[model samples]
Target: MTEPIRISRTGSVETWTINRPESGNAITGKDVIAAFEAAAEGANADIAVRAVILTGEGKIFSAGGNVKEMADRQGMFGLDPIEQRWAYVDGIQRIPRALGRLEVPIIAAVNGAAVGAGCDLAMMCDIRIASERASFAESFVALGLIPGDGGSWFLQRAIGYERAAEMTFTGDRIDAPTALAWGLVSRVVPHDELVSTATELAERIAQNPSHSLRMAKRLLLESRTGTLESTLAMAAAMQPLAHADAEHQQRIARWRSS
Candidate 1:
């Protein structure tokens, strides 16, 4: 069987593509855990990989979780359930947290529809770049499910509580331009240029000192919940470590000589 996720590397960037195009890249139960593990391992292992780009094959970025699989599990476990639901939630949470925890940057290249968990998947990335064809929706409410992934956490953070509440409650789809206007996406390009534009952005990030980028990502992620004074203290502690790195010294010397 083919891998549900395809991973490729170019210089300091790793691109992860959701491979189930026929089903609009819908993730299966197994795919969710596997993809998360793979991404986390990649981030941990490769010091050279400074950024990650997430995209999907063919038309749709993702249609979210496999509806058929959900139906099948529902049939097996019955209607009123708890254990199975929690298991599914656990799997969903793992993927997004893994993506968010990665020290390097993550950029989502949304080529088409990113519905339900798919939308959360993109939101989990540090930056999102969408194609003109892209559309987003929380979608879980329509399916009689809550956002099982880190959707609740990230959505509120991304667009604020009111907007996130509105989207989650109504389950209405938002177009690329609307997403950009709402600050949900960094940029929107023509469908044809989506991949190229994301690659260019990733390449730019890749050119920076990898250690500095990782440390900066760490600080930004940590700052979300901490007090300003605490965050400042954290930064103060990190600055000397960054300055002491050989990469930082070399760059500083080059700047001085120039």
Candidate 2:
């Protein structure tokens, strides 16, 4: 079988593409966990890899979970409810864990529809850039399911509680422009330019010193749950190390000279 996620390097940037377009890139069976693990491994293995761009092949970014599996009571939904609950704990739940552990910044290039868990996956990233054709929905309710993969948490952070509640309750689709207006995505580009636009953004970020980039990302993640005072203290602790790094001194000199 082919890899569900494919990782490639261009300079300091790593691109991870979801390759299961045939099934609309659905997170079915083990693919969701497998793909996320690959991302974590790829990012960790290469010290030179500075940034990551995640996009899906073909039209849809992802349709979320496998509808067929859900309906047929196969795959992750197999056996009894108790078993399925454990399946979730051991299966798709790993995606968020793997992704959350990645120190480097991640960019999600949503090329098309990202519904249900798919939208949550994009939200897991540090930044999101969507194609004009892209749409998003917290669509678990539509299928009589809740976002068991941290969508509730991610959605509220991305678009706020009011809008996230609206999307979650209604499971309505938000087009790219609306998504941008809601601050769900940083920008929306033409459909054909999605990958290129994301790549350009990743390359720009990759140009930064790798250690600093990772530290900055960690600081942002810490800010999500930390108090202002706590965040400030953490930053104070980290700042000295950043200042002491040779790369920091070199960049400072370059900046002053230029």
Q: Report per-prediction Cα RMSD to one decimal.
A: 1.7, 1.2
Report the number of the highest-TM-score candidate: 2
Task: Give lDDT: candidate 2, residue 50.
Answer: 94
lDDT of each candidate versus the true structure: 0.86, 0.90
Looking at candidate 1, what is the lDDT of residue 38?
80
lDDT of 1 by residue, 103-199 (tens): 8998999999999989998888899999999999999999898887778898989999999999999999999999999999989999999889999
User: For model 1, what is the C-alpha lDDT against the true structure?
Assistant: 0.86
Candidate 2 local lDDT, residue 209: 88
C-alpha lDDT (0 to 100) for residue 7 of candidate 1: 86
Q: What TM-score would every model get versus the actual structure?
A: 0.94, 0.96
lDDT per residue (tens digit) for residues 71-159 in model 2: 88777676788988888888888888899889888999999999888899999999999999999999999988899998998999999
Over 4 Å off in model 2, which ranges?
Answer: none
